[model samples]
Structure formats: structure tokens, C-alpha cells
Target: MVSSDHIGPNETGRIRATVKTDGKKGRILKTVQVETNDPVRPLVVLKLRANVIDAFHEKPLQPDAIFRSPCRKCHLDRGRDQMGAALFRADCIMCHMRGKSAPSISSLKKLSRERLKEAIEEGVPDSMMPGFSWRVGGPLTEAQIRSLLKYIKGR
Candidate 1:
């Protein structure tokens, strides 16, 4: 929430937010979008990061855990009906974007198409990357995977 809806020139205001960490662990990133009237930059994105430690502490969560319960509310349900770039932004970008645990788009673009496909379909072994294919206990369907592949490749 913002301290005020309006801020005069040369004035400052506070933007505060809260996050629920109940079933979440490890590094989590959340974004807040602020809309301004400035002609130069109308919208600003603020990133909030927190290392949520519950009983798990610093242990890595099972990749598939994101597909369950509370985590799925943000990670899975948001992208359920999305495809292509929209899907990436909703489901993948939070972790895969710059300065996160997952590989950024620049690095991912370097992989061969076949290798990238395999990575998305089968996921990296014993890593935080989970296979997105529904056949592998993930939420993505064959068509969604194909759409994501095309979107990533085109990036």
C-alpha cells in the first residue's frame, strides 16, 4: 500500500507491502507496479525479495512442491490459462528472470533448441528446475509446453 495517492513535486511517499510466507521457502521475489503521471516513465516495477525460512530452513524445496497447495496459487494457477509470453511472465519469469536462482533468459537463449526442449520437458536432474510437462507430474500440457518453447526460442 502507498502512504499517499498523490505526491507533490519534490516530495516523497512510502510504498509498503506485505507477504505471507506460510508454505514458502528459499528465495522469493515479488513485484509491485507503480503508475505515475510522469511522461518519461509512466510505470515503475519494484522488486521485493525475501528468504523465507520455515521448518525447511535453507533446504531446497522439491521442485514439484510448487505445484501443490499454497505455492500453486501463485506459481501454477496464474499461468493455467496463459500461453507464450504471458505464460512466461506469470509462471516462469519470477524465478527465471535476472538475479534469481534460475537461469536468465540470455543464458537460456544460448542452448540448442533440442537441449532446451529436453530441459523444459524433463527438467535438470536433482535441481530446482522442475519438468513443466504434465506427463511428468507438472501442470503444463503438451500444447502449453510447445507454446512456451516457441516463446522462449523466439526471445
Candidate 2:
């Protein structure tokens, strides 16, 4: 998206762009090309770079904040009545997918079933990974946790 299609002589224009940081992290780079009438520089390329932080990157002062308000919309609601890959896509992928702060799906596949189950139920110590089991104040139920475990291990 651009601010304007044309710029008058001796005038300046703006180029605007938006990147969806959801399910992504680390350094991100993108490029945009603009065509101009200037003979000396008919085309200009703009480089956009950003460092995405995890949605839960904030201090542990409010670990359960994700289960409330605006965060709940994406973190909780999306996983309602969902199971297996669908559930992971809705709830887990945002942070656990590639390039994000948490472990990627491929990496998770390497863990034993018991380890994965414990992580999901009890969360990891001193890490951003939060417990998704109801006993730990998370939104997932026993059945859901089982489903997630099965899905993750199968992958």
C-alpha cells in the first residue's frame, strides 16, 4: 500500500506497508518496489525489516493474561471445539511454529510422549511455555490435552 499514486515536482511521497507478526518471530525482512518517472532512478526498492517478539514475551507478572480479554480472542476462542491439527493451528501454532519463540512442530516431534504431555499440562519452567490444562488455570481440558498430545507426537 502506498500513500499516493503520484507526486508533484519537488514534492515528497510516502510508502506504507503492514506486516502481520502473528505466528512469526525473529528478524523479518521484506521488500517493496516502486516505479517512478525520474530518469536517473526509474525504479526504487524499499527494504522493510523488523524483529518480532512473542505475544507473551512480557515478564511473568501476568502469565495468565493470555487467557483473558483481547488475548483470549486469539489464544482461547479459536481453539474451542477444535481438536488435533485444527486445534494446534488455532491455539498452539502462533507461538510454537517455526521462527517463533517456542519449539517448532518438527522439534516437538522429537520429544517423548510423556515429556510432551508433562509440558502441556505443567508448562516448562522459567520459559514462555504456559500450561494449557485447566488445573493450571489454562483453557484446555484433559481430553483436549490428550488430543493435542496425540497430534503433536504423530507429527
Candidate 3:
């Protein structure tokens, strides 16, 4: 849904927003999409249930889709444009801090799942690494973090 302003014909970025349906019972869902302009990004026409009732339906385009969420850094971007890559990129702190000797997680060059998980839980001290398990203001939820790990593992 990244619209014309944030996403031109060729800007690589991310889309994250929520969709919800209101009724006797409703649910809110968060969605994320990453894309490079190689092929015009496909419009995602998500058909969703508007309420807890299976019969209810609602389809809302993500705000980030309407307004592209530009990634802060593009130099480090490899093919990790996917959400899995974004999760792995979280480890860039430790990878680049160690410099040549440290593994380059920023490159999206796959890493052992366990290693990446460890990096998330117990960051490399004295380096840019920071533990998400108890970060005072970091955004990832435990479930979200696990989902990202599982997704990367599958990849």
C-alpha cells in the first residue's frame, strides 16, 4: 500500500500497519511487507474477517503501505528485504562492532538460528549489541521475536 509519496516506482522499503474489524467481537492484525522495485510490488488484497464471527469480513490496506516506511540504511541491505532479514539485521550491532572478525549479519548472509537467537537474548557486551529480552524501550515482543527466528530458520 505504500503510496506514490513514500514509494515511487523504485524505492526499496517496508510496510507495517494494522487492520481491524469492529462488531460484537473484533480483532486487530499487524502486517508487514518488504519489497524492492524490481517488479512493481503486487497489490495485496487481503480479505479478512471483520469480527470474531467467521461471516464478518473486512479488508484494510496498511498505512505503511499507503505511506512507505523507508529503511534507515540501504548500504547494508542484501536480499534481507524480507521480515526475516529485518530480524537478522537486529544483530548488525554485534556483527559490525567486531568489524572484520565479527560475522556480518547485516549482509543477510544467513546465520545459524541458535546464534541469531543468542545474539538477541544476550547481546555481545562492549559492542553495539543490546539484549531485547529486557530492553527498556525496544519494540519487539517475545512472540514476535520468536516468530522472526522461526521464519529465518525456515529460510
Worst 10 residues of 1 by lDDT: 52-61
**lDDT of candidates 1 onward, in order:** 0.84, 0.84, 0.46
Candidate 3 overall lDDT versus native: 0.46
* Residue-by-residue lDDT tens digits, candidate 1, 1-155: 89998889899999998887755778999889989898999999999899986664256788878889867877888898789899988889878889888899888888888988888888899788888888898888888888888888898
Q: Across residues 26-139, which tens digit of lDDT does each residue of candidate 2 receive?
A: 899888888878899999988989998876555564556678886788778999988988999998988787978789999998999999999998888888677888998898
- Models sorted by lDDT, best on top: 1, 2, 3
In candidate 1 the C-alpha lDDT for residue 6 amounts to 88
lDDT measured at residue 52 in model 3 versus the true structure, 0 to 100: 61
Query: What TM-score fits each model?
Result: 0.64, 0.63, 0.31
- Model 2 alpha-carbon drift over 4 Å, by segment: 1-61
Task: For each of the candidates, give the backbone clash count.
Answer: 0, 0, 3
> In angstroms, how far off is 148's CA in candidate 3?
2.4
| Top-TM-score candidate index | 1
**lDDT head-to-head 1 vs 3, winner:** 1
- TM-score, structure 1 vs. true: 0.64
